[model samples]
Target: MGFCEVVEGRHSIRAFQERDVEDASLEAILRAARRAPSAGNLQAYRVAVARASSVRRLLAQAALDQGFVAQAPVVLVFLADAAASAVKYGRRGETLYATQDATIACAYAQLAAANAGLGSCWIGAFHEDKVRAALGVEEPLRPVALLPLGYPAEVPRMTPRRSLAEMVLDIREDA
Candidate 1:
C-alpha cells in the first residue's frame, strides 16, 4: 500500500483473531524497525519478542492488566539502551536520544504491521519496573512500549485528530 494509505489504515487494534502471525511477516516488521533512523547512527534500541503464552500473560499483567496484550499472537517490547548511546554522545544521548530511537523504531514496526495486513496496539501504560522484571530486561535497557500484534478481530473507528491550524505553529520574522 502507499504511505498515506498505510498511515490512514493503521489504528490501535485491541481485538485480535486466534490465528498466528506468519514468520515472514514478523521478520518484515522487525526489518522495517531496523531501518528506522537514529541519533549518531547508534540505533541504541533493543526489542524483545514474546511469543510464549506464559510470558505474554505476565507482560499483560505488567501492562496494567490489559488482556489484549496476552491475547495477541506476539508481544514486542521496545527498549532503549541508554548506556550504548551514552558511549558516544554522553548524558544527552542517555537521557533523550536513546528513548527517541526506541520510539521511532516502534512506530516503524506499527506501520510495517499495518502494511502487512496485521493489527497492532502501541501500549505505554505499563509499570516500568514490573515490565522489566517480567521480560528479564536489565540495566540501561529502558522499556518504551509494549506492542501487541496479530490479525484483527474487530475494526475500530478512526479516532479524531487535531486540525493543522490547531496543532501546527508557524513563526517567521516576516510576520
Candidate 2:
C-alpha cells in the first residue's frame, strides 16, 4: 500500500484475534521505530516487549482495566530515559527531548505495524505508578505510551478529524 493508503488504513484497533505475533515481525516494527528521527540522535528511549500471560495481566491493570491490552499478541511499553539525554544535554533534555524521542518512536512503530498487516492502538490513559510496578522500571524512567499489537478482530469506522486548513496555520505575511 502507498503511504497515503497506509495512513488512511491505520486506526486504533481495540479488539484483536488470538493469533500470536512472530518475533521477526516484532523486530521489524522495532526497526521502523529505530528509523525515527531523534533529538540530536540521542534516542533516549527504550521499549519493553511483554507477551507473557502474567505480565499482560499486570499490564492490563496498569492500563486501567483495558482488557484488550492483555488480549493483544504483543504489548510494547515505550519508556523515556530522561537521564540518558540529561547526561549529555542537561535539563532541557530531561524536560523535552526524552519525551519527544519516545513519542516519535511510538509513532513509527504504529505505522510499521499497519504496514505489516497488523493492528495497533496507542494507549496513554494508564496509571504511571501501576505501569512502573508492573514493568519493574526503575526511577527516572517514565512510561510514555503503551502499544498493543495483533490481528484486529473488529474493523473500526474512521473517526472524525479536522481538516488541515482548520489545524494548520500559514504564517506568510504579505509585503
Candidate 3:
C-alpha cells in the first residue's frame, strides 16, 4: 500500500494471534526505525526487545496492568539516549532532541509493522521507573514508548480524526 493508505489503514491493535513474529519481519521493523530522521543524525535512541514471558509480564505490570502488553509475542521498548546526544548538543539534545528521536523512531516502526501486514500498539502510559527497572534500563536512557507487535486477532475500527480546517491555521499580514 502507498504511504497515505498505510497511514489511514493503520490502527492500534490490542488483540494479537498466538504466533510469534517472524525474525525477518522484526528486523525490517527495527531497520525502518533506524532509518527514521534523527536530530543531527545522532540516533539518540535504543530499542529493547522483550520476547520472554517473564519480561513481558514485568512490562505489563509496569504498564499499569495493561494485560495486552504481555499478550503480544514481542514487546519493543524504545529508549531515549539523552547522554549520547547531550555530548554533542548539550541541554537541548538531552531535554528535547533525544525524546523526539525516540518518538519518531517508534512511529516509523509502527508504520513498518503495518506495511508488513502485522499488528502493533504504541503504548505510552506507563511508570517510567518501573519500566526502566523491568527492562534493566539505566540512567541517561529513558523509556519513551512500549510497542507490542504480532499478527492481529481482532480488527480495530478507525478512530475519529479532526479535519485539516480544524487542526491547521495559516496567517498572512496582507488581505
Q: Which candidate has the top score in lDDT? A: 1
lDDT of 3 by residue, 1-175 (tens): 9999899889999998999999999999999999999999999999999999999999999999999989999999999999999999999999999999999999999999999889999999999999999988788899999999999999786799999889878676677
lDDT of candidates 1 onward, in order: 0.95, 0.92, 0.95
Better of 1 and 3 by lDDT: 1
Q: Of the candidates numbered 2 and 3, which has the greater lDDT value?
A: 3
- Stretches of candidate 1 off by over 4 Å are none
Stretches > 4 Å off in candidate 3:
172-175
Better of 1 and 2 by lDDT: 1
Using TM-score as the yardstick, the better of models 1 and 2 is 1
All candidates: CA RMSD (Å): 1.0, 1.2, 1.3
- Model 1: residue 27 alpha-carbon error in angstroms: 0.4
Candidate 1 TM-score to native? 0.97
lDDT by residue for model 2 (1-175), tens = 8988989899999999999998889999999999998888999999999888888889889899999999998899999999998988899889889999999999999999999999999999999888888888886899999999999999876899999999998889986
Q: Write the per-residue lDDT of candidate 1 for residues 1-175, one digit (tens) a residue.
A: 9999999989999999999999999999999999999999999999999999999999999999999999999999999999989999999999999999999999999999999999999999998888899888788789999999999999877899999999978676675
